[model samples]
Target: MNRCLSGLVGILFVSISLVSCQTDEEIKRQRYITEGILIFKNNCANCHQDKGQGVASLYPPIAGSDYLRDKKSVICLIRYGQQGKIVVNGKVYNRPMPAQPQLSDLEVAELITYMYNEWGGETKLTNVKDVTPILNACKK
Candidate 1:
């Protein structure tokens, strides 16, 4: 009976330890994705829709978009807004996407992380450390 109890305890401890072993980077990535969802709902949902399917002939879809091929341009446009006509998946959208200058570099990083993970076929975080320099350079 004693040996059985000890073995059970050891197994439980190992299980708990394994469950708690998630890397810090993964934790931060999850947090960024959570915040990004809220940001999108508040700032982008009206035109882009909740699932990023876009509004007919006006806004462009973000999910499965060919436009996402230009990561740099996507990042720049998020902060500086977009003008003129743009094509997405062979459809032309002429509406202006107002700039979200209020979003901090961190917020942009979080947003991109969420977007890429959810739709851009990415499985990694887009760290704020990487986003700041890009944002700084795009400031006009």
Candidate 2:
């Protein structure tokens, strides 16, 4: 009976350990989303709206935007805010988006991740490594 109980306890421990161990993909996805939400709420929600739909033609709608779906362009825009006229969903938004250079690459990646996942996009995860180059390239 003692041996049986010990075996059962060991199995329970293993199960708990496995449950606690999140895969890299899962961890990345969670990190990406959580960071993204915080950054978005703080930096973007005012102009882009809480849902990323933007406020009329004043700002561009980020939610369900074809522009956001293009990872390269999106990264560029995030790293260095676009100047002059830009169009989203056939609407022209001429306002300049101020550069958020204060944020780290990791934070920017997280913000992008949150925007992609929350706003009718696919499950592709954006990591710091992927974002760093784009951020560096933006300066040149």
> Which candidate's TM-score is highest?
1
Stretches of candidate 1 above 4 Å error? 1-12
Candidate 2 residue pairs that clash = none
How do the residues 1-140 of candidate 2 rate in per-residue lDDT, one tens digit apiece? 69999999999999999978978888788878987898998998889988898888798899988777578778777767889988788878898998777788998888888888888556768888989988787674
Span of ten consecutive residues with least summed lDDT in model 1? 66-75
Per residue, candidate 1 scores C-alpha lDDT tens digits across 43-84 of 888889999998888889999999988887889999999999
Error of 2 at 1 (Å): 13
Error of 2 at 36 (Å): 1.0
Q: What is the TM-score of each candidate against the true structure?
A: 0.90, 0.82
RMSD of each: 2.0, 3.4
**TM-score of predicted structure 2:** 0.82
